[model samples]
Target chain A: MEARNIKLEEIIRDENLVYTKTSLMTDKPLSFCPGCGHGVAHRVIMEVVDEMGIQADTIGVAPVGCSVLAYEFMNIDMQQASHGRAPAVATGIKRCWPDKYVFTYQGDGDLAAIGTAETIHACNRGENMAIFFVNNGIYGMTGGQMAPTTLPGMRSSTTPYGRDVALMGNPLKITELVAMLPGTCFVARHTVHTPLAVRKFKKAVRMAFENQKLNKGLSFIEIVSNCNSGWKMTPVQANKWMEENMLPYFPPGDIKVNGEMVSKTAKSE
Target chain B: MAKIKGAIVIDIEKCKGCELCLVACPTDVIRMEKKVNGKGYHFAYMEQPDNCTGCANCAVVCPDGVITVYRKKFED
Candidate 1:
């Protein structure tokens, strides 16, 4: 039998949708590059916010970076922070409105580099807020400079010779460092290269927000994302490279659950 | 026998044709359209609607968040 040509309107009218854009996202087209993980990461966070019915009470602090305009895309209360100052700004917001959900969305260069002091202090103080760090290894928005999380021997415009570990210090595992601190209650590193990974990331995001409601100190989520434009590769190639290179160095899994460090064996599972 | 039908609606204007959804679809239900959107990039379309299980894999992987998946149940 010949397959029927069904119209999309028919299905919509039938109301059998399995998936649709979250209401938390504005109608504005994402300014991110095509196939960039930032868009996926944004969607995952918005999806969680929408699902949890916390859009009104939730406030997001976007750091100075590619995501600086995040307030334009996310349909909620948002604040723009100076480079690497999102954590501190979030701390103020959460402190002012302890009952509200507060989060900081930051990038590698912003969070792990210049903002390292604020990030460390905020997590160490056990601020009752969520921190979403997008680690793409390089300064993507600022013309592909070396970032604190950039892997050794990784090539960036600033490190054209493929980062020489001898000249530059080793890549800083900021997430792991924060997890070791007593203030961080939940810490996880996730990616969005696959469907399963996106699901896992969403779960982590939701838990991070839930932690805020529980007043459970700090919840930090690091997404090891890809910078296809900065890496000078197509989206597919970037994802493949990230899987082969980034995954090994920054393994994706829960580092700390409920203020307890997860065993290495369970992390690999 | 029970027949299942699935469909994907692409917001043609919103799609950048990154093809992430194409690779994510387990049943190979999506293909890039020859026509480009306003952004001057090819948009995705349902190439084989019959095979779609509406698993939402394509939607999940879409960076642009432009695709919506729908499934219909019917008797054959």
Candidate 2:
């Protein structure tokens, strides 16, 4: 008999080598297309939850639209809210379980458009929770349509001829506008278009959770994300496009941190 | 490679004006200029030319595809 040489370790290994834990919880693999910023934002949220060691004590509220099914990927206790109702859901969660870390994950369509009222009221009231808003400029889940945050002159299904300010209006700067509110304890805008950018985004997400841990009121993050399918760009191009287009439109910085008015030069210790 | 006053340079067209460099720059040598580019975006310029340590933070955060920082040759 010929000596059989099979790479058993690589093929049929069932020891610790095969028991490597995945950072992402196994419920549903990401449905986001290649280069979608939603993936990056979701991953960052998970990383923060892990870093804070609050998986068991954390309650995440899912919004309608693209991230509506976020509960599938995140193994922690999750709640599904009505369209643009994440803030309201989050409010109930935090109040019902004051000791648990509460968070709301929303998309631009959910947070900026339909859910605008809920988001504003929640921030104004200084609800003790964290909000992650992903602004991809269009309503992705409902077939690429114009969103409140869709930039002027950017064509979408609803604004096929390119956005006309007179008719369609201009993009809404939800993050900056909300930062002006007095009740928000922490506010920042960031993106994950690059590796270094990812690091910074993670830092911001971590701070948001930290605030929740300390019960320091609400912390809001506006993530300048990408929707390659809607944008008609490849994953790589989408990232580059966001870097060149979106970041300029919204400069990244902590609008407010711990009630301290932070400027572009300020950094949280 | 020698002491030729090495500095950082930014490609303005690619810069998104995120100001990541300002935060990363240890010497506080960078700040966003009020003058908007043709693209309607702010460009980060040297606040104090001599303070730049060439750490490349601004280049890293630039979202608009702008930025390249480097030093001019010292006139010895």
By TM-score, who's the top model here? 1
Write down the worst ten-residue block by lDDT for model 2 chain A.
A1-10
lDDT of 2 by residue, A1-269 (tens): 11122112222223212111135454354566544667657766876788678888999999889888888877789999999999999999899999999999999999988989999999999898999999888899988999998888888899999889998778888876677787788998887766577678889899988888787888999888888889888655676777677777766777788876686432322
- TM-score of the second chain, each candidate in turn, equals 0.90, 0.67
The Cα local distance difference test for each model comes to 0.89, 0.73
How far residue A169's Cα lies from its native spot in candidate 2, in Å, is 1.8
Residue A98, model 1, lDDT: 93
The superposed Cα distance between candidate 2 and the true structure at residue A194, in angstroms, equals: 0.9
lDDT (0-100) at residue B53 of candidate 2? 41
Q: In model 1, what are the clashing residue pairs, if there are any?
A: none
Place model 2 in a CAPRI quality band. incorrect
Off by over 4 Å in 2: A1-24, A264-269, B1-76
